[model samples]
Target: MKHLFTPYTLKSLELKNRVVMPPMCQYAVSSKDGIVNDWHYNHYVSRAIGGAGLIIIEMTDVEPNGRTTDFDLGLWSDDQIAPLKRIIDACHQYGAKVGIQIAHAGRKAEDADIPVAPSAIPYDENSKMPHALTTEETKEMVEKFRLAAERAIKAGVDTIELHAAHGYLIHQFQSAFTNKRTDEYGRDLALFGKQVIRAVKGVMPAQMPLIVRISAREYVDGGYGIDESIAFSKEYKDAGVDLIHVSSGGEGPILAHGKPGTHAAYQVPLARDIKQALKVPVIAVGRLDEPVLANSVIGNEEADLVAVGRGMLRNPYWALEAATALGKETEIPGVYGAGFSLKK
Candidate 1:
C-alpha cells in the first residue's frame, strides 16, 4: 500500500510527505555575487505552497567561483545567510522540511573563464578548460564546502546535500574521463569524494543529516558506472551520509544514449541497483509524472523514495493531487479543490 504519499524519515528529520523538490537551476536570479533575491524566495515559496513534503533548496554554491551561472545562489559569504534564512523559514511555515544543497561547480563555474578542476578539461564545448587545483587551493575548497555546510546549519536548514555529481566539482574528482591526473587526489576518485564528505561532517551538527546526489551511471564508455557508484555510496553510508538520492547519466550535458528521448523510468534502474548495494535509502528521480508509476515503484520496492522533477514543475500540488486521485486521504487546497478533477 505504500505509495507516493508515504511518510519517510532520514536521520532526525521527518518529512511531512514523500514529494521532494529536486534541485533545478534558475538562472535569472543573480549574476556576479549570487545574492538571494525575491525571485529566488518566491520561486521556492510557490513550490512549498504547492504541497511538496520536503523542499531541497537549489544548488547553492559554496564558493563564489563555484557558480555555474552568473545568476546562481551563493552561500560563500555570511551576508548570504540571512536571505537563505527567509527561504528556510517560509518552507517551515508551510510544514515542509528544508534542506540546502551546497555545491562547488569546479570546472563548471560560469563566472570566470579560468576555473579549477581535477584536470584541464571542459564540461562542454562552451565550457572553459580549467586549471588544476594546487594542493593549497584544493585544501581551500574543502574549507569552503565545510563553511557552507556550517552556514546552512546556522540558517536552520534541516539537511545539507553535497553536490557531488552532475558535472560539478566533486563530480570532477569522481569521474575519470575528466580527471586524468596521477596524484592521490585525482585518480583515486573515492578519496576526494570522501574528503568532501568528511570535511562537511566536521562542520555540521551531530543531529543534522547529510545527503549526496550522485549520477549513478555516466552512461558512457570508460566512465563511472553503477558498481563504482554503489561502492562510493557504501563509502558515503559509512562516512555517515543519511541518504543517497539516486540519479544517473550525467557529467556531461547530453548523454551518448540520448536522455531527453529515453523511456520514463530509464534512470530508476540505477536507483534500484544502488538500493540493493547499500544499507542506506535511495531516492529515484526521472520522468515519474504519473501517480501509478510512482506508487508502483515505491510499492514494488524499486526505490525507497521517488523524486518528481518536470512533473512537479508542471503541477506544484502534485503530491496532494496524486494522492487524491489515488483515493488516498489527503487534503486539497481550497482555491483549487472545488472543481479539480483527476479526469479533467
Candidate 2:
C-alpha cells in the first residue's frame, strides 16, 4: 500500500488510509438554528469520496452561545443530529471514516449574549470581554461536551474530537495569559485542559475513539507554547485521549508564524514531540499540500496522520490527484458522480 494509503487504527476504528481532512470552517450554516444544511453534507462528502481516510468536520459548537461565528455548526441539540448523520452516513458509504470536532468557542463567540471563559478576559483589545463562568456554569459546560459527544455518536461519526486549541474558550483556560482567576478552574494553568479531557471521558464510550485538537504554541508572550502543549498531551494520554491533533494557535494575522517556517509540514514537530513523549498517535497538519511532503512525514515517522485543510479545500479531488502522483487511480465522491463520467 502507498504510505498515504496505509491503514491507521485509532482506539476502535481503523482508518482505510492516512489522509485526513482536517476540521475547516466553511461558514455555511446560518445562526438561525443548529441544523447543518446540504452545503455541509456536499462539502464533506466530496472529500470523503475523493478518498480521504478521515474527514473531521469543522468545530460543531456544543451550545448556540458557544459558537465562534453566526454560521458555525452545532451539535448542542437533537435537531442538528440528522444533518450530521447524513454527512457521516455519506462518508461511511464511500468507505471513509468521519469524525466531528466539537467545541465551545468561549470568548471567541462573536456578539454573544453570554460570553464565557474560565476568567473574564478580552479575546482581544477590540474584542468584547467575556463573562467569567460560574462554578455551576463550568460544570454545565462539561456536560455540554458530554451531550455533544452523545449527539455525535447518534449521528454515526466514527470518532469525536475535542477542540481545546485555538485561542477559544478551552485555550483561554489553558493559557496563563488568558486565565487569571483565583478559583479552582483558574488556580492551575492546566485546569481548563483537564476539564475538556474529563468532558471527553464522560461522554464518549470506551469503544469510541477520542481525539483532542490543541494549539501546540500560542506564539504570544506568556501564552501556551509547544512545551506546555506537550505536557498537556501527556496529561491527556493519561486521561485516555486516542489522538492529538496538533494545530497552532488561532492567533489572527498579527502573529502568524510557525516553529520552523510556513513551508509544508511546518507544524509537524508539535505532533512529533508530543508523540515521542506521550507514546500515542499524533496528527500533523498545516500547509501540507504536496504528496511527497505528506509521504515524508509518515514514512520517516515524523507523525502518524496528516491533516490537509486548504489544500483539500481548493481541490476536493486532491487526495485522488495525490494518489495518482504516487501511481494510483482516483475516485471522486458520487455527488459529483456525473462530473467524473469519463473516469467511470
Candidate 3:
C-alpha cells in the first residue's frame, strides 16, 4: 500500500511522493501583461527546493478577460512562454514535476469591464452583471484553451490542469445553479468541460496526464452536490480526463450561507467518493495541512494524492518537514543536505 511519502505514477509522470501543491492564484502580475515576474519564479522554485512532489502553478488564464484579475498569470501569448519555462526547468532539477492550471474566470472575472458566463447571471447581487456568451464565442473559447495548452507544452510542463471549479468559466457551464442557458450547452451541462478536455488533450502529448478540478458539492440551495458531480466526473473521464482534483463551493457566495463545513480535510470525503464512484486517480485538497492527516488519507487509500495549500504557503519546506515528522526517508537536495540530515 502507498503512503504519503511513497512515489506515485500517473501516465508518464512519476512523482517523488504523493504531495501536491495545488494551484493558488498569486495575482502578482503587474502592468496587466499576464507575464511571470521574479515573484513567480522564486515562489515556485522554493517549493521544489522544499520538496513538493508536484508543484502546480496558479490559475493561468487563457485570455486577458478570462483572468480573475488583471494581475493573474496568462499563457495566451508566445512571449509568456520563456519565464514559465524557467520555473518548470528549475523544479525538474530538484525532482519535482510542475503543472499549470489553465482556467477562464467567466462571470467571476473581477477585472473585466463586464465578465462573460454561460448566461448573463451575476455572481451575486453586488457583483457586476456579465454578458452571456454566444454559441460562436463559446466555440472560440474552446480554441483558446487548446492554444493555451500548446503554449504550456512549449513551456515544458509535465501536466496540465483544467480549472472547472470555484464558479469559473467552465464551472459556470457545468452547474445548473448558475447556468440558465437556453442553448445546447445549457441542455448538456458537461459539454463545455468535455470539449475543453478534448481540446486540451489534442495539444498535449498522449503520455501527459490532464487533470480537471471540479466542485464536487455546492453550498447554495440550488447548487450541485456529490451525486451530480459524480455523474459529470464520469462524463469527463470518458472525455479524456485522467485525474480529478476534488474541491467544493465557489459557485456563489453560498459557502457564507450554505451547508459545507470548513474543518481539516473537510473535502476528503468528496475526493474519496469520486474515486470510489469513478475508479479514477484523484488528488484530495482542502485543509490537508497537518502531516498526520495528509498521511492518513494516503494510508487509508482515501486519496491517491494530498494537496497542502495554506500549510504550504506558510512554509515552503512543508514536504521536508512532513518527511521528518513521519520518519520517512526522503532526499533533501545536496545544497540543503546538511540542513535536513538526521545525523545533525
Candidate 4:
C-alpha cells in the first residue's frame, strides 16, 4: 500500500515522498519590502534538510496592497525574483521541491489603506470596508495573478499553487456571503477563480502542474459546503488546475449550525469526496500531525499527499521523526546520522 514516505509525481514535479510542508505565513518580512531574508531562508531550508518532499512558500501577494500585512511577501516587481530564487535553490539542494502560493488578501488585507474586493463589504463588523472592484479593475487583478506566476517560474519553482482559499481575494469572489455584486463575477461564483487558473496556466510550462487550494467547507451559515465546492472545483479543474488542496473554514466566524469537528483527520473525508467526485488528486490537510494517521490517509487512498502544517512548524525535522516512527528508510544527512541511529 502507498504510504506517506512513498515517492510521487505529477507532470514535471517529482517528490521523494508524499510528505508536504504546506504554506504557513511567518509574517517575518523585515523592511516591509516583501523580499525574503535570513528568517525565511532558515525556516524553509531547515524543513528541506529535515526531509520534507515539498515545501510551499507562504501566501505571496500580487501587489503591495494585496498583502494581508505589510510584512507579507509580494511578487509585484522584478526585483523580488532573485531573493526568492535564492531560497528555492537552497531548498532544492536539500532535496525538497518548492512551490509558492500566489494570492491577494482583498477584504482581508489588514494593512492596506483601503482593501479591494468583489463587493463593497467589510470582512466583519470591526473590519474596514473594502472598495468594490469595477469590471475592468477585476480583469486587471487577473493580470496581476498572471504576472506573479511568471515571476515564480523565473524563481525556479517546480509548481505553483493559487491561494483561492482562506477568505482571500478568490474566496471573497466565490462566496455569496461576501460577494454581493451583480456583475459577471457574481453571476458565476467560480468565474474569477477559473480566470485566475487559466491566467496562471498561460505563463507556466505545460509540464508544470498547477495546484489550487480551496476551502472545501465554509463553517458559517450562508457559506458554501462540500457540494458547492465540488461544483466550483469542477470548473477550476476544467480551467487547467491539476490538483486540489483541500482545506476548510476561513470565510467568517464559525456558526453553531455549521461548526466543524475538531478531531484529527476531520478534513480527510472532504479531500476524499473531492478526489472521487472530480477524478483528480488532492492534498489533505488540517490537524493531521500524527505520522501513523498521516500514513493511513495515503495507505487508504484517501488523499494522494499529506500536509502537516502545525506539526512541521513545531519540529523542523518532523519528516525525519516520522520516518523513524513508521520504520521507513529515509535519507538522513550524515552530519545528523548519530541522532537517528538506534543504540543496540
Best by TM-score: 4
Model 2: lowest-lDDT 10 consecutive positions: 251-260
Candidate order, TM-score descending? 4, 3, 1, 2
Q: Clashing pairs in model 1?
A: 30-71, 31-70
Per-residue lDDT over 1-344 for candidate 3, one digit per residue giving the tens place of the 0 to 100 score? 67999999999889999999999999898779899999998999999999999999999999999999999999999999998999899989999999999999999899899899999889999889999999999999999999999999999999999998988999999999988888889899999999999999998999999999999998888888899999999999999999999998898875445356557888999999999999999999998899989999999999999999999999999999999888788899867857774422
Candidate 3 lDDT score relative to the true structure: 0.93
Model 1: lDDT equals 0.80
* Per-residue alpha-carbon lDDT of candidate 1 for residues 1-344, written as tens digits (9 for 90 to 100): 67777788876778866778888878866447677788878878777877788888889998777888778888888988888899889878877888888888888887766888988888789878899987678878888888888888888899888888788888778788778878877756767778889998988878778889998878666788888888878877787788888877567766466554268877888888888877578778888888888888888888877888888778777777777777665545556666455442
Clashing pairs for predicted structure model 2, backbone only: 334-337
TM-score of each prediction: 0.94, 0.92, 0.97, 0.98
lDDT of 2 by residue, 153-259 (tens): 98898888888888777777777877888788777666666777777777677888788998888777556677788886787777778888998867433353444
List runs of model 4 lying over 4 Å from the truth. 257-261, 342-344
Q: Candidate 3: lDDT of 275?
A: 100
Give the clash count for each candidate.
2, 1, 0, 0
RMSD of 2: 3.0
What is residue 19's positional error in candidate 4, in angstroms?
A: 0.5
Per-model C-alpha lDDT, please?
0.80, 0.81, 0.93, 0.94
- lDDT top scorer: 4
